[model samples]
Target: EGRRRGSRAEGGAAFETARCPLPPAVPDLLGRDAELARLRAEAAADAPGGVVVSIVGHPGVGKTTLAVSAAHELASRYPDGSLAVDLRGTDDRPLSPRAALEQLLGALGLPARQIPASEPEQSQLFRSLLAGRRVLVLLDNAADEAQVRPLIAAAPGCLTLITCRRALAGLETARWVWLDPLEAPAAADLLSVIVGPDRVLAEPEAATELVALCGNLPLAVRIAGNRLATRPNWSIAYLAGQLRDERTRLSSLSAGDLQVRSAFEMSYGLLSPSARRVFRRLAAIPGSGFGPELAGVAAGMSAAEVQVRLDELVDVNLVQAAVIPGRYQLHDLLRIFAGERLEAEEEAAERSARSEELLSYLLRTATIAGRAFDPPVLTAHPFASLDEAAEWLYREASNWRAAQRRAAAAGRHREVVDLAIAMHWYSDGRTQQQPWDEIFALGAESARALGSRREEAALLNFLGWARYFCLGDNEGGRAAHEAALALAVEIGDRTEQAWANASLGSVLTRMGRPEEALEHARRAVDLSGDLPFWLGQGSIRNVLGTILRVLGRPGEALEVHRGLLADIEKHYDEAHPFARRFFHSATLQCIGLAQNETGDWPRAAETFRRARELFGEGGNALEEADAALNEGRARREAGQYEAAAECLRAALRGFTGVAAWWPRARALAELSTVHWLTGDAAAARRYRDEALALCEELGTPQARALACELA
Candidate 1:
């Protein structure tokens, strides 16, 4: 997928990438220095309708070559990153705007769950993610204006370079840089680069004839150069004789599918059956990408068998499997001609049916596997195949993820939601936010169309969780949560309501209304009592416990927490790492707070020590810092001034580099008391004042009081 950033056609490489930058080498670059400069000058915009450079040309006129080169020239200026996408505009299907955005989000390293399911949200997010980053985006092989708009970035300091066969020169502020055929001299230079200078120098007359016959197209000239380099004994005059015939002239460069069949046949007729089969079957792909699948469907062979055939094709330079671990596309002109062969020389219905079959197979598998991971709550399916379902979902994640957006274009909402939910397990580092986000967005539309408020509630609930927990957009999170809750109430689905409650609790937590968050959590837990595997329960308890301790209700909170810990150790899998840590943390914090409130300061300090150790085991630095802060306070209140200083310093050591923002104030406050006790009244006053300043800045009430009244 030569997947570049920003645009959508290509596969996304994971957003926020840190790969080795493109090397100094750039190829097929011609006559664009002035165009490049003009583009750079017009790249910036404070608002929408920024400079969109469209390089239009006929097929095989080197549009992509120039686009890539121009983007390369402008790469360093955009520090955030650069992106590229090949819109499949030339073939039967064109790239959808949402699919393109999804790929771009992945390449940009946006989270998979964060991708919006709706086109508008995807576009909005595409712009938002690009808003502050200085990135150069190249959209190559685009079909039309509608396909390009959603992926366009209008942010200042960001530039967009688009290459299409048609001139969308009408778009505002878009500088059109049309790539005509290369000049004979430039074509001659390129030919020289491929073949020996001596070969060109030896046949100047024939070389001029050759360039003329190629329509001065770079791809054609390059193919001619390759043929010449290999056939050292063949004279240019002999080649010219073959080229003089228009019937065989373009065919002279064709090696079957390697170049263009006419061009390739001109080149390919020189090869055997092995190469021809490789070219024809490769052209039969339904998707832009190919692997063993095309060889299986088109050539009626397995992956391993196709590899041997593909190797022969690659050896003759008829195929370029550059899409590591997958087969690749033939060149634009070449694919066009091969497709023509597939139409005339092969059965049309068979190929079309095969294409549909492949896509359907992908969707069905994606749906089943997706349902396995996140099965419908009220559905009749028991969701029992633990291994097969999960295995299938994991294996076909890419196809289903792609299918959700693909189906959305045709308004297939059920497939969109079903497919996205199946991909829950691997929705982490790879892929991106737009794919799933758009899935839910479309699912919302689909639910409305079907008049299924329950479905709408579920989609909104998923969207709410995604926005709240993944992206940290509190207002959006709150709205989505409310929307989900209202819809759930309308449908009278208690389970959906339960999820919405948990989601609302999350938003309230972020909104700093912990009291409301606790109430919401308690309601969700009560609703979840009859349900199975409510993962959110533990998370809710963790939040509620923290809130209660913060609100000075440690006694009530401890009784609830002790039972939770006991239940975790008894009914839950204690061998699970997360389970062990959760129980350890709840036990330690609740007990520590209760003891501290009851004036058993030594017991409070000891309990905090255990919590700190457990967090250290979990590699949870922030939680460890919290534990240390608690013990430091207990020590200071107990009048163990030196120990209090030691505990605060230890907390600082763990939190100094990390953003332990809330605990930093407490650590400073405890440290100031030590200073006051150690006979340094000036230092104590200074530390106290500094702590108060930090507390005020972060809006932490207790830290402010401690700093103002104590040390």
Candidate 2:
């Protein structure tokens, strides 16, 4: 009786209580009675959040048949209806979790546009939609735990059945059912059901021999039966004799054109010349799966052409279609088959050319995507819009990341350097989300190989930045920046020199060496020379202002930030809003911190509010939390204890969301100060103790100061 709102297109979001209309169950499945009984018992005993029952077997086994039969028999128990999906687990291109979610949601009446872009967000939304609903979700041929995890219902009354070739041992909650090839009786029974029990009974010995020849697999047995059904005159002995050869067993398991190889060859033969070329070339890709767009690059066709051919291949099951549109995968045997064809038909030069083309396409597309976040590159670019670029980056992340490593191994040093350099700004926000040291390390090595000193210096600087800010390796950062400085000095690249000094200053500040940091910051500012407001000068100034504040000259820091902000306002290019907002937020945060230091509490609060807004607008959650913490500090200094507590709590929430422990600890300390000001000694002590412990664990300066104060 439950109802859900449809998307806007479906009658203005009216509720429609509906259930998944599962496909008809396969008929006459043999040797699965025990497995079926086990599945039903488990489903009945499943917890409120549901249970995952994974049916694992080799490819061409009867796993899918058993799952469908079980779901049909147990349909009445789940009134909310049953859903099923093919995950293409045995194929190189298995379905993506996000795409699987989209299908589930679509079946539940949500439209494509309504689905969230990110997998995490989509998963949350899907879970919320399924809350309290009793549903049977059958995920067939799932690739791994990751693909199935997001689709498993959390509702109490739901049951999820998964089928895959591998055991998926990583899914700890799953109940395992390993399907071995059918026993002799079951295999003979399955063939009899497909052909006819009378025919099978008439030649029991031949039937048994034929089933044995088919490897006792349901798919092979069914195909063998199908072949015999069409040729009623052929004796079971004749068929068994035809399949006796092990090498040609698969080839002989055909009825006319329905032969195993014929089934594949027919689909392969039907492909347009270009699609066949791409399909075989794809076997050369190292990754297990690839997106449709990449298939175009591999085939030397346009995106539109690749999609059409991929669909044709999927139609005949030559290629397994992923739940996510635009993704296609081949089964292990199919990939091997494709490789055989590729080796036999294609020239070495042709294979190498296709591989290089794919690499080039991935490199170019990655550069375009990364440019969306980098100020200097995005200022006047026209290849892709920001949204398209960002979408491409996420949707094709695996493709390009693999390509980067492959190209590096192939000694495409210049291309690798170009790709890594383009990611400079984009990498800043993803320090924790990605392992960037590998990319930058390879880039630096490639730059050195190419004898490009400027590229090497930039790569080293980026490497150092990631180490300091993301990994907390201050010593590693210091070494890399020193190398960058040495190289910049030798090459006489003033821009790189400024960047090296500014980057070093930032690292030094974090290491608590304010005086040495100040020396670098001042030189960075002097060398920058106003190339463009946010490009180099603004960056150097922001570090300079921070160093001045730590040196206990808040008045001077405030003066520096004030002048920088005015200059930025005059020269700020609105062309790349994302980059502009990031640079401006840093300025506002510095100015607000300086004001807080000078006891301009009210002004500081206002400045922090602006900085928080800027950070939020730019999607910088960590920086936004820091801004909120500063605002709280300003309010606490102004004696507005209640408001200070509220602001600090907001900062705490933001920090927790991003798991920024250091900032979270600072917010706790600020809340402790607010409690003390409000005369709550017990509350103040509790908060202070927690903050002190966290700071000690983190080895922050706050720990030392708090220890001295307590003593």
Candidate 3:
């Protein structure tokens, strides 16, 4: 009953009754139950002054629809009347406070001639009219706090709900409610309602994908639903496939006047020119989110200036702050819109140049960060500390990964190979192995394309490590190392040959062929003897020690490992801090393994614990997890069940965090053994079952062997 009704007088002004001009509630409004409840509760709450609540979000997020619906539901509480007005906040000219007061006055049955001349006077007169009345004032699409402040009623019983694209945080007295895109299920339900439930039910997978392609924004979903509903003959999958292309996604989201692009255009048109430039250029960034430093590079602005522009964009809902502080992201649909603007307004040469600038910055910065983990003392770099370097590497990983791909695609072979080679040592400590596989594959291809045999051999060795250690592909690792060794020999690159031989030794050791692995390990050691400390000698020694331990020569392995540690200590002062910690940790871990094979459980446990601490200090999460596993095994053998369980759990956490399924499975199996030893059969069974499931999923030799032992 929020409709305006009365007979028109001779002057054509309606002889208004108690005014209720609220729009019709959207029937079965989906995905806003929580918001509606909060709005209604705020409206009903008693305050000294009238209650004012602002609903804020990006364009096409249904702020107006929600305000209208809330107003209609809460109309009964405001028995005197309810009034609504569109402030056109996203328009070229937003409604001024004076104009807004005039509209409210007219809605309250005041004649045009009787309205006050000044905005302050009009606001006073308007509040005076509603002083004792229980009215709901709905200011739809408010431009800012200034436009809303003057219009709020002074009566304590009154409630004013203002909706805007901006947050209007300056309204200190108002309670704020922010809207994100609908949740996936709610979005799917909304689509199900718009398209027949039967159709959605028939193609549930496609329906889910279609709503996701819509970015879960209500308006976009409704538009897609309408398009699908009208095209009865078209399958939902076909429509989803059409929208999958980012180049035409916005175009496909349009159905008549209901255009997602048009909705974005209105908000975009309101941005300052500089903000507009930054917003569009940000589409060049590859990942879902990016930090201010990268944005600064893209916009050619100082970080401080870029932050200011980012705040401006955030206020208007053009950009959103990510879960991580200081990072921002554009909505999927909005990113597409920005890309469209980038192509349309920017010159092709200019776009290419800007893209190259960003890519160059990403690669160069990544190289610097990666070097912090490499051998020898780290040279002068922008990062002030090892932790800062690591943080930048992980945070900007997506951006730099994309840059690598783009560079490779553009045939910038030298740059791609350089980045890949720089990341070799850094990749060892990374959380996931898959990224290294992709990176090294590109590096190898680029090196081959450039006909740089030395680089090719080096990248091939790195690729072998990735396949063997990261991916658990032993045969693939063996093949890659063999190929690298052949190339190294062909070119007479002794350092590359040494690394290739050591990599082969490690892979062969894992393949259950310690004898064959010993040959490779010994050859690698011989080759490494004449090379520099950082040129594979130290690493080759570690590989040799691991092989010696596997071949039932723990005493010899211990000797070799001790010698490696002694050598590392001599050059310790010359190594980067991260390299020092990481190498010491690695060597200690090898010594611990040898100690364990020699049945010195106590010493092995202590060594592994120290290695774990060193790995943690070096920020090598996966290696820390490995150290934890080793410690747990030693502790179990030493009859410390409680300590073993604790260490194993820590290992599980580290493995799970990195999504290292094989290692996680091993941790689970170890926990199962610990639990069984502690007389917890059910716990043991549960852990064993979980481990077996993962083992089956991995299908690796080690995984299968563990699975069989448990079975």
TM-score of 1: 0.62
Candidate 1 segments exceeding 4 Å error: 1-180, 197-206, 231-300, 312-345, 364-398, 407-418, 425-434, 442-459, 473-492, 511-519, 533-536, 543-562, 574-711
lDDT of 2 by residue, 170-279 (tens): 98678998897889899899999988999999999999988876667787787677667867897888777767654543455423212344334534655678778777
TM-score for each of the candidates: 0.62, 0.70, 0.60
lDDT score for residue 294 of model 2? 79
Sort by TM-score, top down from the best: 2, 1, 3
TM-score of 2: 0.70
Better of 1 and 3 by TM-score: 1
Of the candidates shown, which would achieve the greatest TM-score relative to the real structure?
Answer: 2
- Candidate 2 segments whose C-alpha is farther than 4 A from its true place: 1-179, 188-211, 218-278, 286-291, 331-333, 372-374, 377-379, 382-384, 428-434, 551-553, 573-577, 617-622, 649-711
Per-residue lDDT tens digits of candidate 3, residues 202-317?
99999998887777778777767766676688788987876775555444443422246644554565678999989999989876569888999988888899999999888766
Question: Per-residue lDDT of 1-711 in model 1, one digit per residue for the tens?
Answer: 000001111122234533212323346565556666766666544435445778887766776766777677777888888777767787666667876776676567643433544566567657755765777788878888888888887777778888888898557667787776777788887777777788889889888877767767776676776787788898777776766675654444433222233445556666666556556656755455566654564566677877787776665566666433464555555567666656655677776665565556667766665554332321333445645655545434544555555667767666665655554433421233334455566777677766777878877876665565545467887798788888887777887777777767767867888788778767776766654432444545544565566567877767766666666656555234543574467467767887787788987888898888887787666567778888888887888877878888888666543434346666777788789788988888887787776666555466567656653
Better of 2 and 3 by TM-score: 2
lDDT for 86 in candidate 1 is: 68
Better of 2 and 3 by lDDT: 3
